[model samples]
Every structure is written in structure tokens, then in C-alpha cells.
Target: MIEALAPVFAGPLDFARHWLELAEAPEPLPRRPIALSTLLEEEVQRPLMARHEARYPGGDRRAALSMWTQYYCAQYLLSHLGAWLLLGRMLPFRPDDIAVLVLEDGTPDGFRLPHLGAVAEGPVDLEPLIREHLAPLFQSLQRHHRIAPRVLWTNAAVRVSAALNLARQQPDVPPLRLLEAEALLAKPCWRDGSPNPLHGTQSRVEVEGEMVLRRRVCCLRYMLPGIAGCGATCPIKEGQSAKPLPLLKSA
Candidate 1:
């Protein structure tokens, strides 16, 4: 049954059927409000951090949590939100509507999109879908996590950017029509320093005589002491003078 549904999904991602049920709310919403970020941090983010720290050892606890929160947040965006970007669809943005699935390690596994069956079923347009449905999700997440709307959206775009690049490399599924996906990216969205998706529909970047896909924001992954340096895409790395955004360079 799962194999049959694989093609419709983004790669290196999967969902637990039970998590999907919880996200859907079972026709009776819970007594308490659902706060996605809080839920994820407690249930998913912190756990993953603990696992990583256990396995790797050495790092400031608070900083590790922050960095792992950013990393898993990016992973969540990559698997769930990015699936929509690849399909050019949208998911519901309400507090109760957005839920994440995670591995036992607390890494983001995938997501459950309540009331988003139609979009998942396909044949939808990307631009209107993102603006109407997704934009609101970022706003809601901002409220829940107390993170900036731009920061949340930027994390999402970064994962989307990574997913597209991964798709190009693997080509296991039909290659994402990047040019077409760019149309969705071209639509105005927010990021740390601007009101546009930092990735802006392109993935690979050239920096200082090298091609790199720099993270538009520091995942804060480096702040955890003894953790490896920022990812290849980090704009704040040693000797890097660039501000982390405005993704593409002129031809």
C-alpha cells in the first residue's frame, strides 16, 4: 500500500499513518489548542537534539537545541512543505491543521496535511495554492514558535531548494521541472532580509571561486560547541563576507 503511494511523495521522507490520524483531529478537535511548533519542539525537535548530542557528544545544551530546532525545522519543511512545492500544491495552514511526523530519533519524518486531500490528489496550480494556503501556515508557525514569519518561510524555501537539487541528482522520479517550480518561487515570499524566498527557485550557488549552495540563514548548527562547522551553504562561515541571502548571482 505504501509503495503504491511513494511516487507522489518527496524523497528520503515518509509518514506514519498514526500521526496522520492525529493531525486530522478525528472529527473532534482536541480540548486544547494545537500549537505546531511547541508540539514539534517537545515531541520532535528536542528529542532529535538529544539523540544527536548523545551520538556526537559535546555541545552547549541550549545552543544545541536551537541548532537542532533549526535543522529539524528545515527537514520538516523539506519533506512535507516541499512535497507541495514539487507538486505545486498547498496544504492547510491553521494551527490544528498543520502537524509533523517524526522518526524515533526525533528527526522530522514527514507531515500530515489536514484538509489538503485535494491538493495532494493533484492537478492544481502552484502560485495561487502557495499564496492562499501556505503563506498563512508560515504566519501561524511564526505565532506558535515566536520565530519571524520570514525566518520560517526561508527555512521552508531552503529545504525546497535542496529537494529540487536532490531530485535533479537522483532522477529516480520524473525530474522536477525546475523552471516550472521557479514560477512558484518567483512569487513573492518572505526571508530573513527580504520579502522574497531566498532560494528563489534556484539551488546551486557560486561563492569565492567555488560553487556552493549556501544556507540563506545560519541554521545555527555551528553554535553548538564541537559540532562541525556550518553547512557548505552557510554564508557566515569563516572568511565568508556575504549576508546569507539574495541567493542567485547575476549571469
Candidate 2:
């Protein structure tokens, strides 16, 4: 997959190169890599969460998990969307087909693709990503932690919006790519008619005569010790207490 997309990884789309990788000799992969599917297992997630909690003595579990979700989602969304918008090709993104590099302390490093899936053209549908990859991952995280599904969805939405913005800023990106991204955000619902979680996840506000984008949902990073908030992009109000949100009971 890396060889096939090599040209696209150069010049303006170089940022996508870091987020996606294709591995040679699938087995014996570098680092302490774990299959993304395995990460979903209840047994696998417990120790990972424990590692995170230990790192921040008094930090809330939901905050730790929320930060982790943002990391993984950003990896897939940026790489996948960048390829589609710039190269008009979709690399494999199925959970079963991907692995993530995990550090000893349980933080995710980067994505590793051992195999490639079908390549599709531009104006690609994002429903499969939300339905196939994110929904199940978020469900599993909620099963093991106190974070709300809405919080996870909002985190994923932020990355999705970021990918579109990144692609739009590229000088070589096609007009169709911009139009597709705009239409997707404008639509109130997904193709399945369900509420589009990506919608309204961001808003543009004036900051010193400049319009800056702000996320509608707080990532709760401020609840962790020694971690700084997202600054201007954060939806948290000025002087708001850095408290983890009330634990959301699972359905």
C-alpha cells in the first residue's frame, strides 16, 4: 500500500505519510504492536487503562480514554481522508486489517497496515468508517470505562473535521474534494438517516478579528495532571473548573 501511494505522500500531502504506513513481512512487526481488533477485547483494554491511570495518579479514567480516542481517530481519519482527497484512492481502513503501535505504557504510537483493501475513488463515503470502525471501538471503550459515547463520537468528529480542513488547504487538492467535504458537514444526518455525529462538532468564532475554529465538545484533557487544555480551540469556558465530567452511566 505504501509503494502504491508513494507519489501521493510527497509534496503537499507529506503529512499523511506519517499517519499511515505499509509494512513488509507482516509478522514480526516492529515495536510492541497490537492488532486493533485485539485492543477491543475487554481483557486487553483493562491493563491499558490501568497503565494510563497509573501515569496520572489522580486523573479521571474518562479523560485518559478520551485523549487516547483522539489519538487513534486522528491517525486513521487524516491518513484515509488525505489519500482520498489528494490521490482519489482509499487505502484499507477496516479494523481487522490494521494494527497500531503501542508503547510500553499503553499509549498508541502510530498505525501499521499489513495488508491493503480495495481502493475507491474520490467522493468516498465516510459511513463505513463511522459504522465499521469507530462505533464498535467507542462501544468497547464505554463498556470498560465511564466515558460517554457522545464524548467519544465528538472526539472522532473533531479528527474528521480536521482531515477535511487539512485536505482543503493543500494547493493541489481538487475542487470536488472541497465540495464533498462541505456537503458532508452540511448534511444533518448520515446516509442511514441517523443523526450525523460529525455535524455541529465545531464552530467558528472571532478571535481578535480572526475567525478561529473551536470544538463544541471539550476533550477533558484539562482533568489530567500536568496536561494543558487545548487553548483557544477548547470549548471549555474561561475560569471553568478542570473537573472530569460526571460519570455517565452506561446504557
TM value for model 1: 0.54
User: Considering every candidate listed, which one attains the maximal TM-score?
Assistant: 2
lDDT, model 2: 0.72
Off by over 4 Å in 1: 8-75, 81-95, 102-109, 113-123, 127-150, 170-177, 189-209, 238-251
Off by over 4 Å in 2: 1-18, 23-30, 118-122, 238-251
- Give the distance in Å from residue 137's predicted Cα in candidate 1 to where it truly belongs: 5.4
- lDDT tens per residue, model 1, 1-251: 12323443433545422223334344322222234545634453345456644533454444444444455445444444444544444455443556554454444444455554434453444544344445554454445445554445555566566556655654443334455455445655533234554444234687678887665555454544345555567666541423322222222
TM-score, predicted candidate 2 vs. hidden true structure: 0.83
TM-score of each: 0.54, 0.83
lDDT of each: 0.47, 0.72
Instruction: List, in order, the clash count of every candidate structure.
Output: 2, 0
